[model samples]
Target: MIPIQLTFHGAAGTVTGSCYRLDIGDRHVLVDCGMFQGDKTIKQLNYQPWPFDPRRIAAVLVTHAHIDHSGLLPKLVKAGYAGPIYATPGTSDLLQFMLPDSGSIQEMEVERLNRRNQRRGGGIVQPIYTEQDAQDCLRLLAARDFGSWFDVTGGLRARFWNAGHILGAASIELEVETGGARPLRLLFSGDIGPEHKALQQEAMAPSDLDIVVMESTYGGRPRPKLDDSQRRAVLAEEVTAALAAGGNLVIPAFAVERTQELLADLTRLIADGTIKRVPIFVDSPLATRITSVFAKYLHQENGIKAGAARPFDGGNLRFTRTVQESMQIEQVTGGAIIIAASGMCEAGRIRHHLKNNLWRSNATILLIGYQAPGTLGALLEKGERVVRIQGDEVAVRAHIRKLEIYSGHADHDELLDWLTNRLPIHGSLMLTHGEPDAIGALHASIALWRERAPQVIVPKLDETYSLAKAQPRLMKMTQQSRRLDRYAETEAISGHDWHNDYARLMLQVQHQLRTAKSDLDRRRLLKKMQRILGRGAGTD
Candidate 1:
C-alpha cells in the first residue's frame, strides 16, 4: 500500500493562514492556500517560497472565500499552479471580487512600504501578486454544488458540506483510494459556524469518518448562545450607547459575512425603532461589492423567501464606493455610523476611519469580530492608549468596545458538541488553526473523553504526518525542505513580533520625552539611548 501523508503548511500553531497539503502516493493536492495574518513575521511567510512544488499539485479545494482562507490563490497561480481551483458557486462569486481586492491591497501596501524603504536606503520589494495576477487566477476557478461527489484526481473524490460560517463556507470531505478493501474517508472541518449564526443555517456534515482535520479557532472561549433576535438586541444596545455618546460609531468589520450581518441587524434595529435612524455608511468598496453578492444569495439560503423584504436595504444606508466618497466621510464628525473592512484593522480604509475617530473622546469603536494578536484591532482591544496608524501616532481616547456574541466560530462547548456528534472515528483527529492556549485547552478537554475519543494530534506549522491505516505517525523532514526554522516559526506564532515591540518602544520614548522635566534631561536620555544603540550596532 502506498503511504498517504498530510502536511500542514499554515494555520497549525496560529489561526491565520490555513493551507494543507495531502499527498496520495505520487500525486498531491491542497485543501486551502490561505494567506498568513497577524504578526509581521507570520505575514512574511506569504513572501517565502512554497515548501512543496506548486506545479506538482493536481488540484486545489477551497473551503471558503475569506482572505485568511482563500487570499493566496493568486500568489499560488503566479507561482505556476495551473490546476483547477474547486469551490462552491457562492465562494466563486465572492472571490471574484475578494481576490482582486486582496491583490490590490498587497500592491498598495507594498507601494507605500517601498516609498518608505527608498527613503531609508533599503531595497524595494514587489507585491506577492498583482491585481492582474488575481484576475488571471479567476479563470481557473471551477464552481461545484454542495453534497455532490466530484472527481479530484485519478484516485480521489471530494464533496462539500455547509459550514454555516459564511455565505459559501464549507467543510470538505475527501475520499482517498488505497489498495485496501475501502477508501480512506477524511473530513476537513473548515471554520465551523456557531449555532444561530446570522443568515446561515445549522452547520451540517456526514458522520462515521476515518480522519477529521478540524479548526480550533475558539477552542477555550465559550460565549452565550444568542439567537438572531437576542443577538440584534445586543447590537442595538451598543449602537444606542454609541449614538447617545454624541459621536459617530466606527465598526471594523470583515467585508464578507460580518459586515453583511451587521447591516442586516442595524437595518432591523432602525426599522423597528429599537435604535434611532442614523446615516450608516458602508465605507468599503469591497464590502459594497460583497453586499450585492449576499443580496443575490441571501434569500436562496437560510429559508428566507425570494420575495421577502430585503434585510440589508434601508432608507439611511449609504455605500461609499469611491475614494472621494470615503474621504467625504471624514467630514462627518458625529451622529453617523461608519463600517469599514479588513476586520482586524490590519489594512484598508478601516485604518483611516480609526485614525479619524480613535482620538475623539465621544467616538465609539465597536469591534464585532476576532482581533488576531498584533493587529491594530487587538492593540485597541488590549487597551493600548496610543497606536501608530499609517506612520502617525494617534492617541486612543475613543470608546473601544467588543461584542463577542458576533463571532462566527463555534465556542469551546459548541466545538466539543460538534466533534462529539461526529463520533466513532476510526483513526486520528488532528486539530489546527488555533493558538497554543486555545489548542491546549481543547486538548485537555478532549482528554475527558477517555477511551471514546480518537487519538488527538495538534500538529505544528509545516508538520507532516503519515496517515497509515493503523495510526498516523509524525514524519521527519530534511532541514532544507522546511519553509521556516523551528524557532522562527515559534516566534512568529507567539502573536506579537518585533514590529509590535518597535511601535510600543517608539510610543514609550515619545511619552518619556514629552514628560521630561526639562529639555536637558530629555537630551541626556536621548544621548544615553544613542550610546547604547551605538555600542550594539554591529554586535549582531
Candidate 2:
C-alpha cells in the first residue's frame, strides 16, 4: 500500500465551502469544513450530506475564521465529530464571533423554511446546526501559535505560517510519513492577501514543497488597480458627494476587516474636519461583537500597536446590538452613514436596511467586497433596477457605488508570482476555490509554467492520488526523452499521408492534455499516443 493519499472534498472548481481530507495509513485529518455561499445551486450543496464520514476524522484543522472557510465546523460537530479542532489563537477569537452568528443565520433560515412548509402542508424543517452545536464545537478547539510544528496524525507533523489574508489567517503545511518512513510535504495555500493591505503583515512564501494547493478566486480577471491613496480619495469623494446631495451612504461590509477599515477611514476624515461628523451606525449585532474582538487584538495590528489610538470606540461610531436598534436606523433621516453585513445582502441586518432605504433616491449603497455571481450584492453592483428582499421586491433607486480596496484575496498576477516564488519546480500544484472561468484561466497559465519547470496538477473534488505512486511517471517522462524518440520515428514514417485523420487525432490529444490533472498524467498519455500513432505515420 502507498504511504500517503490526498483527497479534495471541497473548494474544487467553486469559490465557497472549502473542505479537504488527508489519509496516511490508519490516521485521518480533515481541513476546513466551510459553508458554501453565493448562488442558490452552490448554497444548496451545503445541505447535502458530506462526501466522507465525519466520525472517522482524527482532527479538524481550520485555515482561518471566514464564514466560507469555517462556517461548517458546527455542523461537523453536530454530526458527531468529537475530535479537537486546531487553529491559531486569533482564529479562535474570530470563531467566537463567526460560529454563533452562523448558527443564528441557520436558525433564521430554518424558521422561515418551516413557516413556508406549514403553509404548503410540508413537514417542519430543522436548522443544519444550532447555537448549542457551536458551543460544543468551541469546546473542542485547541488554539496554537504559528511557526511551531505539532504532531497532527499518526505519522504527520504540521505547522502554519501567516497567510496575511485576515487577522490570524494561516497557510497550512503538512509533513506526512507512512509506516514511520518516507516523508511527504504538502502545503495548503489558504486564501491569501496582497502586499498592500493596511493592517496585515506581508505574506510569506516557502522555499519548497512536494504538493501545493492554491486558490484562484481572481485568476480569470484582474481587479481594478488603485493605490491606497487613490482608494481613500475615491471613497472620501463618494461620501462627500452623497452628503452634498443630501444622501446617506450605506455600506454593506464584512464585519471583521472591511467594516472596521471603513470606520477607521471615516474617523480620519471627520477628525481632520474634511467631512462632517455625521451620525454613523453599525447595525449588525455580529459586526458589533466582531468589532470588540478586533479592538481586543489591536495591539497585534501592524501600525496600530505603536500607541496609535483607534477611532472605532467613540466619535460618531455607534454599535447597534439589537434588532430594534437596527430597525431604528431608518429614522436617521438624512446625511448619516450606516454599515452592516452580510456583505452580499443575502441575509442579516443589511437586508433590513437595504429594504428600508433602497427606494429612497437620496440613499447610496456602497459595496466593498467581492459579490458572488448570483448574490443580491452582485445584482446591486451590476445596476439591477429591482432586488427582492424577504420575498418583497424593492426598487433600486438608491445610488450604487463600489470601493474595490476592501478585497481580501490576491489578484491574478499576484497568484502566479506567489506560486513561482514559493514552490520548487518538482512540486505539483492544485488550483481550486474559483469559478469555472477563473480555474480555466489559471489552468492555462500553469501549462506555461509546466513547459519551463516543475510538475503541476489542477485537482478536482473526489480525485484521489497516491503521493508516492505518482513519482515514477514523472521520472520516466523526464529521463527517457520520449519526445526525442517520437521525432526519430517520425523521420522514418514521413512518406505516409493522412492529414484529415491526423488533425482529428491531434485535436483529441489536445483536449486530453488540457483536461489532465497533472503534468505527470499528460506525459504518460503523450508517451502512449506516441506508441499508438507509430510516431508521425499520419500527417496533419
Candidate 3:
C-alpha cells in the first residue's frame, strides 16, 4: 500500500495562515492556501518559494473566504497551480471581490514601500500578486453545495457542513481510500462559530470520524453567554458611550461577516432609539461589495428570516467607494461612526482612520474581532500609548475598547462542546490555528475528557506525518526539503520578531528626543546612538 502523508504548511503555531497538504500516494491536494498576517517574518512566507510544487496540486478545498484562509490563492495561481478550487457558493461569491481587493492592497503597500526604498537606495521589491492575478484566479473556483458528497479526486470524496462561522463557512468531511477494508474518515473544523451567531446557525458535522483537524482560536478564553437581545444591549451601551465622548467612533472591522453583523445590530439599535443615528461611513469599497453579497444570501435558511429588516441597509449608512470619498471622512470631527477594513489594522482604510483619530482623546477605537499578535490592533488593544502607523508616529489617546461578544469564532467552552459533539474519533486529533498558549490550554482541556479520547498531536509548520491505520508517525526531512530554517521558523511563529523590536526602539527614540531637556540633550542622544551603531555595524 502507498503511504499517505500530511503536512502543515501554515497555522500550526500561529493563528494567521491556514494551509494543510494531504498527499495520497503520488497525487496531492491542498486544504487551504492562506496568507500569513502577523509579524513581518511570518508575512514574509508569502513571498518565499512554495515548499511544494504548486503545479502538482490536483485540487484545493476551501472552507471559507477570510483573507487569512483564502488570500494566497492569487499567488498560488500565479505560481502555476491550475486546479479547481472547491468551495461553497457563498464562499465563492465572497472571494470574487475579496481576492481582488487583497491584491489591490498588496500592490498599494508594495508601491508605497518601493518608493521609500527608492529614496534610501535600497533594493526594489514587487508585490506578491497583483489585482489582475486575483481576478484571474476567480475562474478556478467551483461552487459545491453543502451536505452532499462529491468526488474530489481519484480516491477522495468530500462534503461540506455548516461551520456557523460566516456566510459560507463550512466544516469539511473527507473520505479517503486507504486500500483497506474501509476508507479513512476525516473532519476538518474550519473556524467553528459560536452558538447563536448573528446570522448563522450553530456549527454541525457528522460524528465517528477517523481523524479530526480543528481550530483552537479561542481555546482558553470563554466568553459570557449572551442572547441576541442582551448582546445588542451591550453594543448599545458601547455606542452610546462612544458617541457621548464628543468625537467620532472608529471601528476596524473585518470586511466580511463582522461588518455585516455590526450593521445589522446598529440598524436595530437605531430603530429602537437605543442609540442616536449619526452619519455611518463604511470607508471600504470591499466591505460595501461584501455587504451586498450578504444581502443576496439573507433569505436562505442558513441566513436571516424571510421578512427581516435589511440589516446592512437603511439608517444613515454611507459607503465611500472612492479614494476621495474615504479621505472626506477625515473632516468629520465628532458624532459620526466610521468603520473600515481590515479588522486587525494591518492594511486597508482602517489604518488611515486610526492615524486620523488615535490622537484625538475624545475619539474611540473599537476592536470587535480577534487581533492576532504583532498586529497594530493587538498593540492598541494592549494599551500602547504610542504607535507607528504607515511611517508616522502617532500618540494613541483614543479610548481603545474591545468587545468579544461579536466574535464569530467559538470560544473555549463553545469549542469544547463542538469537539464533544464530534466524538469517537478512531484516529488522531490534531489541534491547530492558534497561539502556543491557546493550543496548550485546549490540549489540557481535552486531556480531562472522561471517555476514550483520541491521541492528540500538535503539528508545527512544515512538519509532515506519515498516516497509518494506527497512530501517525512524524517524518524527518532533509535540509533541502524544509521550507524554513529552524531559527527562522521559531522566529516566525513566536508572534514577535526583530521588526517589532525595531519599531518599538524607534518609538522609544522618538519619545526620548521629544522629551529631552534641551536641543543639546537631543543632539547628544542622537550622537551617542550613532556612535553605538558605528561601533557595532562592522562586528555583526
Candidate 4:
C-alpha cells in the first residue's frame, strides 16, 4: 500500500490560511499554518479546535513569512506541538519578529474582550496564545536554504524554489516514494507571485509532477502584463503628483515583502531624481524590525543580492519605532512619504496615518495590495467619500491612487505560463487557491493544455477523490461509524452516545459532511454519530 493520504485543511476556497496536511505512514507534515482573513465565518473558524491532534503532526514547513502563510505557528506551538518547523533562512528571521508581534496583538485583543465582558459581569477570556508561546515556537524553527531537498518523513523529500511573491516566498515540491519503486511527486505553488517583480526574481518553473496544487489569488483578474520597469514608471508618475502637492503620502503595505519592495523602488526613484528627495517614514515597528531581518538575508537569493545596498538607509528614509515618532509625523508641513501597515488598513499604524491625513487635500493614499472586502482599505479603494477610523468619522479629501502593478501575485497569463512549464506531455492537472470565476478562467486555460494532453481536475472545498490506488472497502462506512471505529474503545468505556451526542461532539466533522455526498457523506455522518451513541445501535 502507498502510505499517503492528503487533506486540504485550509486555503481550499478562500485565499488565507494556507495549510495542507500530508500523511506518509505514521508521520504527518503540515504545510503552512496561516490565519483566515476577512469573511467573519472563516475568521471564526480560527477559534475552533484542530481536526487532528497537534502533537500528531511531525513537523511544519512554512512557505514564507506572510501572515497568511505563518500566522498560526504560535497557536500550533501553544497546542503542544513540539517538532521542528522548517523555513528558509529569511522566513525564519522575519517570523522572529512577525509571530511575536502577532501574538502580542492577539493577547491584547483577548485582554480587551475580557475587560469588556467583565464590565458586563462575565469572566475572563484567555488569548489563543501569548507572546511567550510565540517565542517558544521560534525555538522550534530550523532554518534551511532554498533549492535543497531534505527528508521530511519516510521516503518523503521536499525542496523549495522562488515563488517571487514576497521577500522569502517559495513554491514547494515534495517527492513521496511509495512502497513500490516509483515515487509520486507533488508540487505546491505557494502564492505564485508576479514574474518580473523589482524586489524579487521571477518565479521558477517546475519540470514535472504527479500532482500540482496552484494558487489562484489573481485567478479572477485578467493578466495585466507589466514588468518591473513598467511598474516603476507607473509608480513614479503617482509619486510625482502626490509630492507636488507638498502634503503627506500614505501607503498601506504589508510590512514584510511589500514594504521592502516599495522601499527598493523608492530608493531607485530617489537615486534617479525621478521622485524628489523627501522624508520617508516607516511607522510600524514590526515592519521596521522585519526590514532589518530582510537586510540580513539579502544574500540568499538573486533578487535581493542584485539590490544588495541598503535602499532605506541614509537619504531621507526614517524608521519610526516609537508611538512618539509616529505622532511627530503630523508636524511635517512639507511633502513626506509614509509607509505603514496593515496592508488593507484593517488595523495598525496605517489607520493612524489615514486618520490624520485623509481630510487633507494635499495628502495621498496609495493602495498597493489586494484589499479583502469589508475592510476599511477596500472601502477607500472603492472610492468612498468618507470613512470612520478609530470611532471618529473623517472626510476623504486625500487623493486615492491605486498602483495594481505592484501586486506580488501572478496574473492570469503569468499563472498559465508557469503551468505550461510544468504540465506533462499527457497527464493530469489540478487547480486550487482561487475564487470561483478565477478558477473558471484557469479552467478555460486548462482546456488549452488539455488539447495537448487531456486530464485536468478542479476541486471545490472539502471535496475528495481517490488517487491511483485501488478503492478501499472502508469507503462504504458512514462518517459516524468511522468516528466510532477510531475511538470505539474510549466511547465504549465512557458510555458516550454515538448518535445524538456525537453530532454535537464534532463541529468540524459535521461541517465536512454538510456538503459531502454519496460514499463520502455516508462515511463522515456515520463516524460522527457512532462516536456519540456507542456501537451497533444506529441506522448508519
Candidate 5:
C-alpha cells in the first residue's frame, strides 16, 4: 500500500499565497493557488517557478475568492493544468469578475514597469496572465454547493463546509483511502471567519479528524467580542466625527466582503438616523459589481434584513466606474463618504482619494481591513506624518482610524473555541498561514489543552510530511541548531540588502554632485547627504 503524503507549497509562514498538496499513490490534488502580497520579499516569492508540475495535479479546491486564496488559478491553467477547479457558487461568481480584474491590473502594472524599463533600455515585460488566460481558466471551474460530497481523482472524497469568513468561503474535509489503511480523514481550515460577521455565517466546527491544518493569521493577538450593536455604535461615532470635521470620510476597503459589510452598516445607520444622510460613493468598479451580485443572489443582502432599505436605494449613494466619475469625487468639498480599493492603498482609485483627502485637516481616513506590511496603508496606520503619493509628498493631516472589528478572520480566543468545540481531534495540529511569531504564539497556546498533550507542528515553506510512515510528531529541535538556522538566513539577507542600499545612496550622492550648478546647490546636497548618513548611522 502506498503511503499518503502532504506538502506545503505556500502560506507556510506567511499570511498570503495559500497552497497545499495531498499526494495519493500516483496522483495529486491541490488546494488554493493564490498570489502573494505585502513587502518586496513576499511579492518576489511569486516570481519563483511552481514547485511541482501543474499538469500532474489532478484537481484544485478553492475555499473562497479572495485574491490571496484564488488569484493564481489562471496562471495554473496557463501552465497546463487541465483539471477541474472546484469552488462554491458564490466564490465562482466572484471569481468571474475578480480574475479578469487581476489580469487587467497585472497588465497595467507591467505596462508601467515596461515604460520605466524602456527608458533604461531594459528587456520588455509581460503580465503573468492575460485576461484571455483567466477566461480560459473559468471553463475549468466547477461550482459545488456547500455540504456536498465530491469525488476527486485517486479514490479520494472531499467535502466543503461553510467557513463563514466571506461569501461562499468553505473549510475542506478530505477522506483519504490508502489501500484500506482505516480510511483516514483530514480537515483544512481555510481561513476561518470570526463570529457575528455582518453578512457572513460563523465558521462551521471541525470534527472526526485524523490530522488537522489550521491558520494562525490572528494568533499573536485576540479581537474583542464586539457584537453588531457595538460595531454600529463605533461606526456611527467615526462617521459623525468625520462629518463634524466637514471633510470626506475615506474608507479603503476590500472589494468583496468588506465593501458589502460597510454598505450594510451605513444603510442601518442612515435608517435609524444615527448619522446625517451623506452621499456615499462606491469608487471601485469591482466592488460595485460584487455589491450587485450580493443584492441579486443573497436576497437579504449584507445584514440589510428583508424589510430593511437597500444599500443604493436611498438615492444618496453613487457608483463611480469611469475615470470621469472617479475624478468628480474630488469636487466634493465636504461631508461625503468615499469607499475605494486596492484596500492597502497599494494601487487603484484609493491612492487618488488619499492624495486629495489626506491633506485635509477635517478628513477622516477609516481603515476597515488588514493592511499588509510595507503598504501605504501600513505607513499611514503607523502615523507617518508625510508620505509620497504619485511622485509628490503629501501631508497626512487627516485623522486615521482603524476598526479591526470589521476584520473577518478568527482571532486567538475564537480559534481556541473553534478547535475545542469540535470532537475527536485526536490528531496532530499543524499551524500555517502566519508569520513565525504568530505561529509560535499559537503553538504555545496549545499547552492549555491539557486533556490531550497535542502534538503541534509548524511546518516551514515547502516542507513535506509523510502520513504512512510516522505520526505527526513534535519537532524536538535543539535550540542552538534552530538559532543558527534562523540567524544564518537573516544575516545573509541583511548583508545583501545593506550592499544594495549603500550602492543606491552612493549613486544619489554622485548624481547630486554632478548636477550641482552653484556653491549653494552643492552645500544643500552636502547637508542632505549628512542628514541621510546620520539617519542611516542611527539605525546601525
Candidate 6:
C-alpha cells in the first residue's frame, strides 16, 4: 500500500483556524478552512496565502457551521476552489444564514474601519470575502446525513458521527487506503462537546481508529466535576440572584447552540418554578436568524432531534431583530434577562448591553462560555476595573458572574476518558484546536494513566505526518514545527482568573444544593450563605 499523509494548514500551535490537508498520492481532501480568531497576530493569519493551492483541493468536509470552523469557505472559493463542500443537513441549513451573515458582518466591519481609516489618512481595507463570495459558495454545499459513508475524492470514504458540540457538529470517520499499505481508519474529533451537555446526544466514541486527530480546547484543566442537575440549579440560582438585584441579567452567548441551550435551560427553570419568569430578550439579529434554523430542524431525524420547542416561544421571550428593538431594551429598568451574541464580546449587541449596564451595581454580566484572551469579555472576566467599549471607558462595578460549566468543549478528564475508550495502546493521537497549555495538560494526562499510551503530539502549522502500520510517522515539517515543543509548558487560555473562581463558586453552590440530602440540610446551607452575605437567617 502507498503511504498516505496529512498536513496541518491551520489550528496547529494556537486555537481558532482549523484547516487540515489529507494527501493520498495525487488527490487532496481539505477539512475545515476556518477563520483565525483571538489576538491580532492570529486574526491576520486569515489573509495568509492558501498553504496549498485551492485549485488542487479535491473536496471540503465541514464538521459544523461555527464561523471558526467554516468561515473561510468563501475565501477558498474566492481562491478558485470549485469542489463539493459536504456537511450535515443542520449544518447546511445553518450555513444558509451563518455564511451570508458572516459576509455582511465582515463588510460592515470593514466599512466602519475604512471610514475611520479615511479620516486618519490611513490605508483602507477590503473584506476577506464579500457577501457575494459567501453566496457563491452556497451552491457548492450538498447536505449528507449522519452515519452514511460517502465516496470522497482519492478513493477515500468518510462518515459523520454526532459530535454534540453544536447543533450539527460531527466527528469525521475516514477510511484511507494506500495502494501498497493496509487501510487506515482515522477519526477527526471536531470540537467535542462536554459529556453533560444539554439538548444533544453524547459525543460518539467510534472504535478501531488507527489515528485520531482530536481537539483539546479544554485539555489544560478538567473543569471541576459538574453534573447536569447542578448546572440546572446554578442557572436557576443565577437568574434568581440577578432578578433579586433589581436589574437585568446580560448573558453573552454564542449565536449558535450556546444561545439555544441557555434559552431551553431558562424555559425549563420557569416551568419548574425554579426561577421566576422574566422578560427575556434575544438582542442579536444573527442569533435570531440562526435560532430559526435550529427550530426548523428541531424535530427532524437528522437535525437537533431533541423532542422540544419553546426555545424561541412565549411572550416573555422577545426577539429583537432590528436596531430600534435593541435600543428599546435600554428603557427596561429591571426584572428582565437579555441574551446577546458575539460570544467573545468582540462585537455585536452584547457590547451595547454591557455599556448600558456595566456601571450599575445591581446589574449582572452572566458569562456562559469560554472567552478567548484579549477579548472584551475576557477583560471583564479578568476583573479589569475598567474596560473600554465603543471608545468609552466603562466601569466594571456590575456583578460579573461566569459559569465555566456551560462550556461546550470537553474538559481534560472527559477528553482523556473519551480517548481511552476509542484509542489503542499504541495508537497515535494528534491534538489540535487548543491553546498550548490545554494541549500540555491533556498530553500529560494521557501519560499519567497509560504510561505507554498513544503518541500524543501538539502539532505546528505546516507539520505533516504519515501513517505506517497504523502509527504516525512524522515527516519533515516546516521550521515552525520545531519551534513548538510538544512538552513545553507554554500558557494558552489561562482563562479569566476571576471568572473561573466565580464559576467554581457557582458550581460548588449547585453541588451543595443538589447533594443536600434533606430540607433541613438545604436550609442550613442557605443559612450559611445568608451569614456570608451578612443577612439575618430569617430574612429572604
Q: How do the residues 1-540 of candidate 3 rate in per-residue lDDT, one tens digit apiece?
A: 667889999999888789999999998999988999998999998999999999999999999999889999999999999999999999999999999999998999999999999999998999999999999999999999999899999999999999999999999999999899888888889889998778888889999998899999998999999988888999999989999999999999999988888888888888888899788999999999999898899878655431246777784999999999999999999999999998999999999999999999999999997999889999999999999999999999999999999899999999989898898888899999999889999999999985767899999988899888836789997797777788877887777788999999999998899999999999999999988998899643
**lDDT for 163 (candidate 6):** 88
Candidate 4's residue-wise lDDT over 287-403, tens digit each? 889878767766654336435377656568899988899899878755889999999897777888898899999889999978765467877888977666754667899999987
Q: Which 10-residue span in candidate 4 carries the lowest summed lDDT?
A: 469-478
Best of the two (3, 6) by lDDT? 3
Which parts of model 4 have CA positions greater than 4 angstroms off?
113-125, 299-308, 425-428, 462-465, 469-540
Superposition error at 219 for model 3 (Å): 1.0
**lDDT tens string, model 6, 367-413?**
88788865788778889766767656677889999998778888888
Candidate 1 residue-pair clash tally: 0
Model 1, CA-based lDDT:
0.91
lDDT of 5 by residue, 249-302 (tens): 999999998988888888888888999998999999999998877776555322
Name the runs in model 3 displaced over 4 angstroms.
304-307, 538-540
lDDT tens per residue, model 2, 490-540: 321221124323433655677689899999999999888777777568532
lDDT, candidates in the order shown: 0.91, 0.76, 0.91, 0.75, 0.81, 0.81
Worst 10 residues of 1 by lDDT: 299-308
Instruction: Estimate the TM-score for candidate 4.
Output: 0.83
Q: What is the number of backbone collisions in each predicted candidate, taken in the order shown?
A: 0, 1, 0, 24, 0, 6
